[model samples]
Target chain A: MSSSTPHALAESLCILTLKSGIWVLFPITVVMIMVGILRHYIVLMLQSPPKKQPRAAIREQRALIRSQIIRATSANSPIPPTYYKSISQHLSQAFADGTYLKDGPPKGDAPAPTAPNPLTDPAAMDGMMAGMKTQMVMMVPQMVIMGWINFFFQGFVLIKLPFPLTLGFKSMLQRGVETPDMDVRWVSSLSWYFLNFFGLNGLYRLILGGENSADSSRDMTTPFAAAANIAQPGQAQDFNKLFKAERDNLEFAEGLYSWVGKDVDTRILKKYGRLPGEVPR
Target chain B: MDLTTSLQKLAAYRPKQSQKSKETFEKGVALLEHGGYLKQGDEGWDALERLALAALDQDNLEVADRCLELIAERFPGSPRVDCLIGIRMEATESPDVVLKYYDELLEADSSNAAAWRRKVSVLRKMGKVDRAVEELSALLDTFYTDVEGWLELADLYASCSQYVPILLISDAQNLMSARYTYALQSLSHALLLAPQNPSHFLQFAETAYLAGDITLSLKMFLTVVDMTDDDDGDVSPSDSIPTGMTLRAWFGVKLCTRRLLTEPRLLTSSGSQTPAPSSSNISTLDDLSTERLRTAYLDIKNESPPATEKELIAVLATLIK
Candidate 1:
């Protein structure tokens, strides 16, 4: 490649001269940042506030949450295995009794897969719509800005990253460029923009608060990463399914062991008092 | 008048590194006795609290005992008397006996928030944190508006926090919802209930910093710096906070500022996901003063950070000149 002139090799520094791609960095940055900010606003606007559920439904969700919290908490909870066991038994019975569920067992035939059918439940539909909205917000801007970058600023190496990477990344990062053996550090304008698109959540936090809708720190939410499954609105929460899962979890849990212990950090902090060894010199 | 005035100053000035003279407290007690100001009222209670605290500071357990005696004798039915008795028990009796004593007082007057607070403190001092958390939560259940209870609960949970993963394997989508760190959850509640707490701000800052929310952490750290600096006259009214949180908050400020500047582009670009802002505190967090954060950061960067922040100290030393 013409990049490796004899005199250039003689300089021996990683820094290489480039063209207007350096100038293009600003436009790309502005675009990605704008997209990120726009995405937050869109999500903010589209977000459906949680609907008021029946008292029974609320109680059921809370019971499940309490169980989940306890599971998370037991890692450090001082409550003995006996305490957990009692709690588990109480929860298990509550679930078995169907005490907190809003809907009751049908005239016969094993409670429900439910009447209006959870697959068509309005609440379930709302969740799916919310999920779709988030996906749309993320995808639409991504496509538009990506195409815009491809059309306007195609080829030219931007700044070198501080970290070194394998030569394999050269093709991925310098896509529009065809200089074989060009320094892998030379990223095209589109690649630089992509970098900013994923990265600027922190800066946005600096400018806006962390909770700002525009802070795309969530990055690309893959299906694998979605925290809640947005079922079709018709689909209701299956308490039976939840109960079975909890039964499985409780069976596997250490709740039966039943001896209370001190939280280790509490014990440590008690011993050290203030920031171990932080007594003013 | 002279004695009561000195006692009030002593109460407020105890945060000074220099120790107070025993004579100041002794004279205050004598003056209160001689002037007959030891009756149940704001003056009497303030003087007694100051005297009791000062005597405790001087390790004059005898004097402390006498002060508690006068408070109880005069107040008779006051909840503050139970608190004083609790403090007295801390000095005199074994913690087991004192805990029982506080529990008895609580059984009598379940509505006494002061007694509840004293009970929590005794539990904390005894290192029964699980019990302490329960008591604090009980206090929250009955008196949800009690910001102090929430703050204590948040602190306890923060100390006890350990990241335990949930097996959300039933659905891959469930995996997307990052587990809210329990400490962060309680702290968020406290912030929502009392947005004015500076210590909670510090706690939020330190916790956020630890959790890799650099922007939010920086914002909270800067908030603490602004609040502390703005009220630079006296030891902060933030009596709930121990000296420990201040140390952490200051350390967090130093660390977060450096991280924010060092890899502004890199940190923002890296695919690390910030947990969703489940806390309303973050949702309400608007109009953050970046100018103040930057300026205060530069100013704070010059000072010596705590020994606990050893990593940041090294980074600070090599920071851009």
Candidate 2:
């Protein structure tokens, strides 16, 4: 029984050795071989010719040697430079002739030119003033309405309504406010609030007011009028009238200003004796 | 007969509620004749009531239709019939079917802007953005004051990055709505259109600066500065300034107007492109690198300056070196 026990133990040890070999040793060997092959392939893909490196190294060394030689040779000789004074005299002569003016006092400061007057042209100035008058006329009613609204609801709330509504309903119309009852009326009120405050009314009005003001000022100025006339010759009068009407009108305002601006070419041709594609001087 | 016996005999003789199909039909006919379903005993009102009841009871659209047909036959010219048809069609929960009813409504009344807007919304929900846009554009063409339609088209163009169309429409409307943001976006796209224009590069620089993209702005500015015809001995400040402006004269002033006090060094050797610092504060000054250079430039660009030559020189030495 003792002998048989020893034999069985030996057999078990042999099996254990085989199992560990299969599990660990075999896979590791395979992995190592795969990794080695991959490394080789990557190296091959990245390989460049050795010729370029050696040539670059040689060139660098040559440049270093050349610079050293030049330094050494320059140190060996220190000669008296006779031609320097003659060169300086010739440069001073040329500097005086070319740079330093012979006519004016040397270092004289001249007065600067005056700013150009834009309103000098009588025709352009007259047209601009006319346009200005029209704009003022158009704006009077709007301004009055605005003032009335400002007085009623405080200035801020009055500015909150949509453009055409604000203009149309100024003092007469009382917009319905929502109460606990009437769900439809409440929903509409909420919608109107959201739309007027955040949607576009506030932003649109701000931009419109700014643009109208700028355009009004530009139309009324002589330089701008002259430039406009030059840009579109015959429509100067129409432009003036249109600008005035757009700027001043509170009650019945349209996108006439924008339309006229966009169609300036056509309007000029129709009104004045200007042709399409005609260049303005 | 005795009283008790007579009562019993009468109870037996009297008919119970009718058991035959014919009798049941007669009962229903009587109810109908008496106007059972009608709310106000109006002609067409009863049909809608019956239809609503049929729809509720059976939970089937066909039954609802049968009820509708009875009403339509009874009151041929009734507007309520059309409204009832629309209600039933909408109850189907199918957009196409609902749209069919809306189309009928439109055909009956062309001035119904509400119906048109609803149709457009349904089309948009179905991912028919182009179709919705077309409908809205048509509406806008007829009624230019329809701001909702204009806004919708603008939104569509923006989402699709069809900027030229957006610009064209906004210009036509005479509104610079989202003009700044749109201009910034267009400036970026313009680079794609003309990759080589120096003027375009300058515009890109300005727009990027405005949009708060400092890195892109700096790169664009450097690109334009490099492209000009004037070739200074080095990439000098004189070379960077654009030509044909009184602004060009101001470049020298800007260069000499740094806030920080430092030194400018002239190159002792031909290979050394940068000037050496002559200021005594050279030991304390930060080392020259890309980041330091950029920070220094930014600091100098946004500061109050001294007008005199001596102060300008001191400032320049600090900023440049």
Candidate 3:
């Protein structure tokens, strides 16, 4: 109808001048800066230093970490065969004795790898709290700024990007601005705000270092999130079973020099032009 | 050779000038003979294995028999005891009997790395290179992370080219082994999966040089040469390199320096090599020279270079920046 409306000629042109780019850019830039500042302070207030564990607990956790490392990096030369067996056997026995177990063995046949109630664990709760805090820092700002844009610039077609996009993105690009016939290349205000949010990762990295918790786009990838996911509530695996699996893995581990155990020196010598046999024989 | 005299010769050939008497071995034997290890489970088993093997090697069947008895009595079902039994058989039985014994052990527990290792070595001793290759492959199929199996497989290929078993003692035999290009692929895997072993770098450098990858070889060789100088009380003295290791590194550096100077880098390959040159090449000509490495080696031997793993890493990290 606007195409044929003669009296509203100048307004009906609907051509956004290049100067209007500044209006969109100014708002987006302000939103990005505000979001970043809010993100830092909120995350700071939310953070708590990891809870200090007793010495025995520390030793037990370290033992688990060490065992895990041994399993992961067994191919590395640091864990010779002797070390492999000794650590596995000691841990296996300790696991059997329930030395570091918080509670008595549950009443069941071949108990599950995890304890039944990780939700009750203080450590796991702490992890969940941390995860929720990071998510809050990321989601709350985008939502607030998006609401602001919707309230003020609901129908404004901010700017057309240099690149062409398919019509499949129309629902996304012209979200609040229900221009049924507008080109997909022309992005609305809310859509342009999201574009800056996702595309400014490199800029954020340049200013905030590679591992800032403020990058809401990276919410799921933060170490806190990962740790929380791993320590799922009511889910704790049995250390006994863990030790057994590790023992099997290590038993089969190839000790790079174990084949000819004592012949390591002889093998090297032979490779470098020494005798295949003993040196002084 | 007599075990005492052979050990004495090894000590002499070592960079350290320490001399050993027959008493040291006896003292070690006496320590194990004590009942202390019997109370400790894992340590007890290891001590028993060590004593048993030493006793077997020294032809002291009585002590070996006692150690083996203790092992069997303590850990009745361990594959380790079975492995000790296999070693005893290798020492006493015929080749075919030992082969059959290992096969039976493998049938009982295919995942027993010790039995599998003994089987491969026995196959190699019998000149069954193809079968050894097959068995080694099977072993590696289950355990690809092991560096030793890769090295052994590489050795098997090298042997196929010119395997003069008796020539293994001669210095000139290096010429024969260096020509096996087939092992280069396997060595690449070794280099990729190699961990914190500085010796692997030395070995890889030597093999790479033989394979004519002058750039990678030079980089690895320089890394080896640098890593061997590590000593700041941080690393255990047991890991300290003797004079021989440095001399071998020096030979590689000298060859690398002369080759880099005489060779045209751009012409070896196409435009691919031009875009990125070796970091060692970009380093100062003084750093790449044979004289500098020799002087460095001498300083290590004489003044004791205050190099730790951290120190050399710092030096290497700053190579470009």
- Per-model DockQ: 0.01, 0.01, 0.01
Candidate 3 chain A lDDT trough over 10 residues, lowest sum: A256-265
Superposition TM-score, candidate 2 onto the true structure? 0.19
Interface RMSD of predicted model 2: 32.8
Question: What lDDT does the true structure give each of the candidates?
Answer: 0.56, 0.38, 0.57
Clashes of 3: 12
lDDT of 2 by residue, B1-321 (tens): 443332222211211223442343344345555656555455335434343444523445665665677677776844445545555655557989878877876776664444555566666666777777677555443333333344455445444333334444545322333333344433433332344455655554454344333323333444444444254345433223334221221222122212113212112221112122333222222121122233333455765455554564465455443
Sorted on lDDT, best first, the list reads: 3, 1, 2
iRMS of each prediction: 17.3, 32.8, 16.2
Candidate 3 residue runs with Cα over 4 Å from true position: A1-281, B1-25, B31-42, B159-179, B225-251, B263-287, B296-321
Q: What is the lDDT of residue A209 in candidate 3?
A: 77
Q: Looking at model 2 chain A, report the run of 10 residues with the lowest lDDT sum.
A: A76-85
- Calculate candidate 3's fnat: 0.00
Query: Residue B128 in candidate 1 has what lDDT?
Result: 81
Candidate 3, TM-score vs. the true structure?
A: 0.41
